[model samples]
Target: MPYAVDFDTVSTAGLESSPVAPALAGLRANEARYFRNKYAHVFAVEPAGDAPEAVDWVHHILDAERGIVISSPALEATTFQVENIRMAYVFYRSGLSINVMYTVDDGGKRAVGFKLSDGMDVPDELASFKFARQRSKLAGTIRGSYFVIKNEY
Candidate 1:
């Protein structure tokens, strides 16, 4: 068989003011359009019976993605399905806990969009979130955490 290849590359370092910013913005717009068109219904949040519209997707992404970035370099690309998202676990530092739920849609058909935490209260002033995930079902045992958010900063 024969094939042709086309590739485009650019730096995404400067962010909003950079030359590549528009492209990134365009991509994000396209993603939003696609999400609205196809999966809008699958994603949403509300007052939950007047508890106050509590989920902050932005914060969730900041926290989770930031954690992923500063974390050990070898721990990217791993996946897991965290549970009990309805509740949270706040540490002694007062940062709330969260479950970054991951699902294998269509039985490996493709990975689904990463959803942010519905409930959490981390302090502002941090450009992005960075943290540790020490999971111990029983006391004194620390599980491992690994992942990264490339687009978020």
Candidate 2:
């Protein structure tokens, strides 16, 4: 079943196994707040096991673009299209969140973003990228980095 992320009252429903569950929940809420504010859309997620295609799409980009593979166990994921953008989000047990943003129209923006939850170390795969900090009431100081998509997927 899908559950809408609640920014007002964050929950770690599917992320309880993570050591940084609180921070992960906050990170999840941050994304929810963003969509609600910018797109007037609700951000919802389901168990990663239930969304194999979404997980596979992310893996395909990671492999093709950078030869990178994340070993972290994905706990929850969601894929949706809104306002011409196809987005896929996966939350890992390591408190890492990755999102693939692909614009539907050709020649538009496409990239993979990585956001680290509070108190989690930068994953080895993303250690080379410099993360910029952004403050959020729900997520605290968020460190984020992204790389532009190089090939069609």
Candidate 3:
């Protein structure tokens, strides 16, 4: 079952297994808010078990583009298209959120983003990328980084 994240009142219903459930939930809500505000799209996510394709796609991109593999288990994931952009998101138990933004048009913008919850340490695989901090009302302090996608997916 997919859950539509509520930015107004963030909850940890499906993310209870994570040690940093609150921060993770907040991070998820922050994403929901972004889509809702920017594109009038509802950001809904399903359990990783129910969204294997989305998770796998994200993993494949991470591994192929950066030679990176996340050790943490993914809790939830979603994939959707808005305008010309195909977007995918995977939230992990370690309070990490990864997003892939691929524009459908040739020569358009494409990138993979990583966002860490307030209290979690940067995972070993992502240590080489420098993360910049941003403050969010719902997610607190979020550390984020990204790399441009080189190969077509």
Candidate 4:
């Protein structure tokens, strides 16, 4: 079953297994609010076991583009299409969240983003990447980074 993230209230009903569940939930909620405000799209997440395709999609890109594989166990994932962008998110047990945003149209934006929840350490794979800080009432201080996608998937 998928849990529809409530941007307004910010809940982590299905993400309790993560070590930093509170921060992860808030991070999820921050994303929900982004889509809701920018594109009027609702963000919904499912257990990682239940969303194999979504997880695979993100993993495929990580391996192909960066030769990177996440070390943490994935707790939940979600994928949605809005306008020309296909967005996928994976939340990990280490409180790290990754997202892939691929634009369908040519010459549009394409990138993979990594975000760390409050109180979590940066994973080894992303240790070199510089993260920008963003303050969110729902998520607290979010440290994030991104790399442009050079290949079409």
Candidate 5:
């Protein structure tokens, strides 16, 4: 089942297995708020089991672009398109959230973003990247970093 993320009332409905469930829930809500505010799109996510395509897409990108592989299991995943941009998100049990933003137009911006929940340590595969902290009312302090996508997906 797809659960619509509510920024107004952050919940851990689909992320209970995570050690940093609260912070992860808040981080999920922050993404919901962004899409709602910017694109008038409701951000909904389903169990990773139910969204293999989205999960696989993210995995392929990680492997192809940076030779990176995440050790944590994904809890939920989502994929959607707004305007010309296609976006995918995977929420992992380690309190890590990864997003891929791909614009359909040639030479448009494309990147993979990594956001760590407030209470969790940065994953080993991502330690080399420096994360900048951002304060969010819903997610508390979020540490984030990203790399530009070099190849066409």
Candidate 6:
């Protein structure tokens, strides 16, 4: 059986009628952006699947588009038990893959952000994180949103 997790559901998964959701709702009240802060954050995240599966998705997406600032090559998963959180990469990167298992998160009033704390091990510097942020944001915009491997072209 397949589950249908749409943009609406996906964006509002952990958030609801709380002040947070309402605040987010208000931000987009009269604006037009593909995805607001609602689903744009993947703090120290697990990519909604197994570690290997997530890494594969990252590889396919980033490999096709090339990369941003990451010097390290290859994609790696920074796993988490929670869902819908976004993690970011913000520095020198290259061809490589490393998993940062633990990440520190600070959920702001609107946009959520995170920091890969000390002692935590990340496979790559963070180039992939940068890419993931952009990719996931676009992904969340697909109405009834979901990700599929585009290996067959």
Highest lDDT scorer: 5
lDDT of 4 by residue, 1-153 (tens): 887799788777877888889999999999999999999998989999999999999999999999999999999999999999999999998999999999999998999999999999989898889999999999999999999999999
Measured on C-alpha atoms, candidate 1 has an lDDT of: 0.26
Query: Least lDDT summed over 10 consecutive residues: which range in candidate 6?
Result: 138-147
Worst 10 residues of 2 by lDDT: 133-142
Q: lDDT per prediction?
A: 0.26, 0.95, 0.96, 0.93, 0.97, 0.29
Better of 1 and 6 by lDDT: 6
> How well is each residue in 1-153 modelled by candidate 6, as lDDT tens digits?
112223343342322432333322222221113223444422332222324554544444444543423343222233333233333221111212222222234432112122221222333434234322211331222111112222331
Clashing pairs in 4: none
Model 1 per-residue lDDT tens digits across residues 82-128 = 23122211111111222233333422211112211112233343324
Which digits, one per residue and each the tens of the lDDT, describe model 2 over residues 29-115?
A: 999999999999999999999999999999899989998899899999999998999999999999999999999899999999999
Residue pairs that clash (backbone atoms under 3 angstroms), model 5: none
List where candidate 1 sits over 4 angstroms from the true fold: 1-15, 41-101, 104-153
Better of 3 and 4 by TM-score: 3
Candidate numbers, best lDDT first, in rank order: 5, 3, 2, 4, 6, 1
| Candidate 5 wrongly placed segments (more than 4 Å) | none
3 or 4, greater by lDDT? 3
Minimal lDDT window, size 10, model 3: 1-10
**Candidate 4 off by > 4 Å:** none
lDDT of 1 at 122: 32
Across residues 7-110, which tens digit of lDDT does each residue of candidate 3 receive? 99999988999999999999999999999999999999999999999999999999999899999999999999999999999999999999999999999999
Clashes of 4: 0
lDDT of 4 at 135: 95
Better of 5 and 6 by lDDT: 5
Reference-based TM-score, model 1: 0.24
Candidate 5 lDDT, tens digit per residue, 1-153?
Answer: 887898998899989999999999999999999999999999999999999999999999999999999999999999999999999999999999999999999999999999999999988999899999999999999999999999999
